[model samples]
Target: MTAPQPNTAATAKARLFGPGGLRDEYTQLATRGRQSDSESREWSGLSVGHRMAMLLLAGVDGDLADLATRDWRELPGPEREAIKSEVRAAKVAFSRLVSLSGRW
Candidate 1:
């Protein structure tokens, strides 16, 4: 039998930016010493679409997942809210594309 295929998206992302590339953010989140399961999973989900967006934008730091952080809140409340809204909207759009891919 063929070996089970891996999550290639996650694998490719790891190669491009090392495993758990957001070490700094994760570290800060786990300042108490270790991360809980929920924190780890949350970071993984949040990074997916954000990573894809960075790849599409061809940002100079596109290959660096550690670039993500909670610093968005440092902005004024209105601007921070606007940025969060855009990110959520973009994530929804990307999910639609994922749902439509293949099966044609």
Candidate 2:
């Protein structure tokens, strides 16, 4: 059998940003936001907390695979809720931003 070939888009995305998965894309966006200041551009990016929330949303395949993962619960109730909201909102906002920017 031959070795598997990686999806170039996914590979490039993961290398420059994250773990190279759809869910991972959320986290990558956060990092990209930090590295750049363009609000319109960075909306797609996320903070570390945002990444964790998105991973959680993605279910079993989510990034928070390990039980040893940090205590998201320990955060203040408001903070936790806010992060969750941000993750959910991000899916819509990011896509709209990307579409409008036409940079893709």
Candidate 3:
């Protein structure tokens, strides 16, 4: 039998969580948020907090999509609830981060 193929999504996630990855994205987002103004025409009028929150939500959705691709059976019950919890926590944390950056 051929060797099993690596999960590309997992590999991508590893890179995203590695040094100079998601952290760097966060830094850029914060910097841009701080520099944003009411007159700035970008992102269709979405605030920095809104943008960050959407980014956070996209990450969570990616995680769930990866899980689904691996095995849909793993998403039921506690696993699903855990993802929900993560979404809630991320929303709060992202909001706090944006607010702390004085962009809120």
Which sections of candidate 1 miss by over 4 Å? 1-70, 99-104
Scored by CA lDDT, what does every candidate get?
0.51, 0.50, 0.51
lDDT of candidate 1 over 1-104, digit per residue (tens): 89999999998776554534565456657776444455344444566557445434433233344435433322235544444466577788778785577786
Candidate 2 on 14-83: residue-level lDDT in tens?
6654324454455548786343334323333545555555556534242353421434432335644655
Best-matching candidate per lDDT? 1
TM-score to native of every candidate shown = 0.30, 0.27, 0.27
How many clashes show up in model 2? 4
List runs of model 3 lying over 4 Å from the truth: 1-74, 99-104
With a 3 Å backbone cut-off (N, CA, C), the pairs that clash in candidate 3 are none
Summing lDDT over every window of 10 consecutive residues in candidate 2, give the lowest-scoring window.
65-74
lDDT by residue (10-85, candidate 3, tens digit) is 9888667554567546755988744233222333355446544544554544543344333212234555455456
Q: Against the correct fold, how does model 1 do in TM-score? A: 0.30
